[model samples]
Target: MTRRVYFDHSATTPVHPEVVEEMCRFLKDNFGNPTSLHYFGQKARKAVEEAREKVAAAIGANPAEIVFTSGGTEADNMAIHGVAYTNRNRGNHIITSAVEHHAVLNTVKALGKQGFTVTILPVDQYGMVSVEDVAAAITDKTILITIMHANNEVGTIMPIAEIGRLARERGILFHTDAVQSFGKIPVNVDELNVDLLTISGHKIYGPKGIGALYIRKGTRWRQTLFHGGAQERLRRAGTENTPGIIGLGKAAELAMANMEQEAAYLTRLRDRLIREVTEKISHVRLTGHPTKRLPNHASFCFEFIEGESMLLSLDLQGIAASSGSACTSGSLEPSHVLLAMGIPHEVAHGSIRITLGRDNTEEDIDYFLEVMPPIVERLRAMSPLDQETEFALSDRCNGCRVSHTCRV
Candidate 1:
């Protein structure tokens, strides 16, 4: 059997062994509701609080500020909708970037339908949202400024700290969907100056179906989305996902401990992959910012071929990767992130994202480099556009302008 290599860590990572072990303990022995009033319940409650502390400490936030949710999507929805409704009287305007995850973009669009004004700020060619544009978009009516910490597709890091500081000065609540940046980058809520932040467990080698939202203490936000028995201090309702939360806490602790080393390793592999792919392949262009992107990510666009075709070819060679954001893969449209960065639809259709993980090594990267070039060449040869270009070039001889059959 061919060994398969996974380069889709940005979509989701495998749960760490430590995280799985920690979760198993909770599932088997401590199977009590945190809300129940008994010894078992107390034990479960203790675990839940400890997990909250771990998550909060990971981001330099207060334990009380972390509210658990289903995943990044729910976390984003909670923050945007929670603040939108809670502070509707203060203002009904929200500001965000065009390259944000659909979690934030769709939620804001839903709010627009409900009569809330929304400003979708554009990004630069490198998929970077300018702090100046964000500053200009703010208004007295802008109640929330929710931008992502980093773009999931191109992996371009945003200017969250600058935007956060601006939001603070203007008295507008700032939120960041940091699902892709939390474990992969140094994300301190205090450093970013954000009032609200979102994180997902699976993105950091924890279990899926569990995530958290950081609502700064005394922030004017409310639990307007979920309505049920008090949980997450009434910020999110329903029984706690005890096992998933425990796994997330364990994962958070592990991430904090190994972040520096893991980032360096991934960065080396990521840059090598980018260097080799762009240098060896013709008509290939790196997609995101050259140096201001994620340490574990390298994305690119190959002319004269479709991303799906290259992905299929790579899959046949036991290499797994992604064309763009996994959430929007079902759509036939090109990536909104790429398009927002001024990438033409034709170019965006051929984009691919390679995100590394803790388990990736130099050998894995070398294997990818070995298999990827031929796949791109194969796809390009099969492309109708490439065929047309080839015929056109053959017809127009370089040596002589008059002769149509000058083979040079």
Candidate 2:
């Protein structure tokens, strides 16, 4: 029998059955537009509001602050563009990290075309953004500081709390894309002190095409995206995605309930996998901050073999994994996150990310461990690249803008 395992929760999770059950009421006989004034509409509206409350509770936020959107991408755009356009008079400068999701990086780039000065902060070798660096980047024209709570590719948790504190002190709006970290770890709006944050449903075993953006009260933000019927309290303008909202709410509730236990379980499995893989495979190094990364994430760079080859080989063995962020997996270019972490072009191409989830277990890890060694061995044996080419780091990183020191 072929062993099957899934280790790509960071990309997305199977929609939890409970979430589907919660969404059923909105989809069937009781279906009604939440915007209508009729009884059916009121009922749908009530359920949507209830879902809003649950999502807010999960993140220690007020329900009024949560604005539903199509997913993390839309939420991210709403938060970043909203702040940039509304606060443009305050400052035309925006600050972000190099390892941010393209949703953020590209949004700021668009803002730059509109004459807003943009700063892309570089990361350390571990893919962690620096607090002092953020402080230094702030000038009189710096209005918004957006960084992700955790990286999608390497899973390194950023110092969002510290950065948020600094942003608050500087009177700059701080936003974080928590799409990959919301359910997998703690995400309190107050604890992180972020003025805005983004969360997605599918990442947490909920329906796709639904997400929320947290906008702190009193933040200078306006509708930057659409012009339609007043929905999401005039923050986002569209008919509400009632089913996805309800599913996401249920998923949030369930994740909060099971977080502590699940985190511990995944941590143990992650540590074991990290330990065994490095011990078994020669010339491999773990990516991301070893201690500051997500509890369920274990990424590695295997010398002399490209990540696409390893992914194909693993898929043949009935294991699902990824080279990096599922969003940019199709890009042949090395991960910007890995390159930002100072990984050379050659080694970054060989990176693989394995993120465990609530459904994963010891048996799955065992099966993966059983197959991974031989697969990596086979891939390396077939490779024409040698250690000297694979191991050389300085040549590629020199004069590259991805790393902080290298850019300097």
Candidate with best TM-score: 2
lDDT of 1 by residue, 316-388 (tens): 8888899999998878899988888766677678889999999988999889888888788777768776333
Give all TM-scores, in the order shown: 0.94, 0.95
lDDT of 2 by residue, 1-408 (tens): 877899999989999998888788789966999999999999999999998999999999999999999999999999989999998888899999999999999899998999999999999878899999999999999999999999998889999999999999989999999999999899999999999999999999999999999999999999888998778888888788899999999999999999999999999999999988877777677888889989999988876789999999899999999999888988999999988887878878888999999889999989888998999888877988764432223533422222222210
> Which portions of model 2 show Cα errors greater than 4 Å?
388-408
lDDT of each: 0.88, 0.89
Clashes of each: 0, 0
Full-model lDDT, candidate 1:
0.88
lDDT of 1 at 264: 92
For residue 213, model 2's alpha carbon misses the true position, in angstroms, by 0.3
